[model samples]
Target: MSKFEQQLNQQLHDLAKEKAPQRDLWRGIELGIEHQHDTGTVPQNRHRRLAAVAASVALVVSLSWYGIQQTSVPATDHPTGQALVKALSNQHEQQKQALLVQYTDAPAMTENWEAQLAELDEAASAIKAALKEDPNNGALLRMLQQVHQQQITLIERVHAPQWQQI
Candidate 1:
């Protein structure tokens, strides 16, 4: 089609017409095998090397797991964590209810706004369940806060003025 493609095709065609190697390719391999047998030099067992690599990986993984377990804070260790989570949850609920009340008469820009809110609520419920198990988890706390913020944001966006969106 193009000049580059024509050149590529011509080169491939030329290579296809070239003669193959004249000598037997297996002769070199057979000589090497005979030489090794004469010298009594055996090839190293591949399984032993594979096993050593596997053992090293296993050791490193186990040590890393142990280190992580030792460093992480236990769920039940922090007595005030659950109280804090409950307080935050209560505040978020109140704020959400107030927001809904304020926007009760406003029509949402998107038809699926309620469905989105429901999904966020479900995510929040799951996070709360996880918090019950590991109350002191900082990452989970942050995720819960983010999800709550997102719910509030989504509500505000859907009810916001079209000019404000622009």
Candidate 2:
């Protein structure tokens, strides 16, 4: 044979020799049956398989129960969140309108000062109500702090001596 054909034949022989036999599953079963007959107790380990199956079933049931229980909890919006928002908005609007000046040509503007003050007081009361609802809300608490400061300043402004020292 030529050198190339000789090398190919050797490779093919090696491949054929390396092929492993198929498994004889029935032989293993026959051996197990013979062993069982000899031992009379079978050595089956069925108890271990049963325990594993039971553990898997228990895990499934526990997970299913947890999923059901978690789904049943009702989520709701906090009423305090609404109150906090209202208080913040009320303070914001009041601050915006606090700079209003009486128009000299508008009689209605000059005539309604007391009524406007009453409305502002009502707004302040709403802010206080919001604070009562959400005492722990940071935004509401900060607004409340500002409200107290504004109240003190307003009182001081009203009570300060008018040109007495001047």
Candidate 3:
């Protein structure tokens, strides 16, 4: 035969000679079936399997419950967080009211100054409500602080002499 054909034949022969699995898996299955049939234990095995599945589910649920309890913040921290937010908001409102009263007689550069302040108040209230829901959220607290600061700055800027000219 040619060199290429000889090589192909050798490859085919090697493929044909590949060994099968070491053990007969079907024999083991047949023996198990026979044993179950002779002993009348099929129903018991099914029940055992069901019990194992139920135990695994219970274990998973217990672990999840433990994880949630562990990850939750301490109960004492919740009130403290809300209290801090409350104090800051009270202080902000007092300052905002004072600024509004101070600038009431002053000529505001913007005609819609009250409307703008109302918008800021609305935004602050929304943040405050969100904080009530998630008291420990630092970003929400910071945003509330920023909105209050903006209100103060707006009041000052609109009543300033430079803004009046512009």
lDDT of each: 0.88, 0.61, 0.87
What TM value does model 3 have?
0.49
Best prediction by lDDT: 1
Off by over 4 Å in 1: 1-79
Residue 148's lDDT in candidate 2: 48
lDDT of 1: 0.88
Instruction: Specify the poorest-scoring 10-residue window by lDDT in model 3.
Output: 73-82
Model 3, span 34-102: residue lDDT tens: 998888798888889999999999999999998898679686654457798888989998998898788
Clashing pairs in 2: none
| Candidate 1 vs candidate 2, TM-score winner | 1
After best superposition, candidate 2 residue 111: deviation in angstroms? Answer: 9.6
Candidate 3: clashing pairs of residues? none
Per candidate, the number of residue pairs that clash is 0, 0, 0
Indicate the residue-level lDDT of 76 in model 1: 60
Clashing pairs in 1: none
TM-score per candidate, in order? 0.50, 0.26, 0.49
Give the residue spans of candidate 2 off by over 4 A.
1-117, 161-166
What lDDT does model 2 reach?
0.61
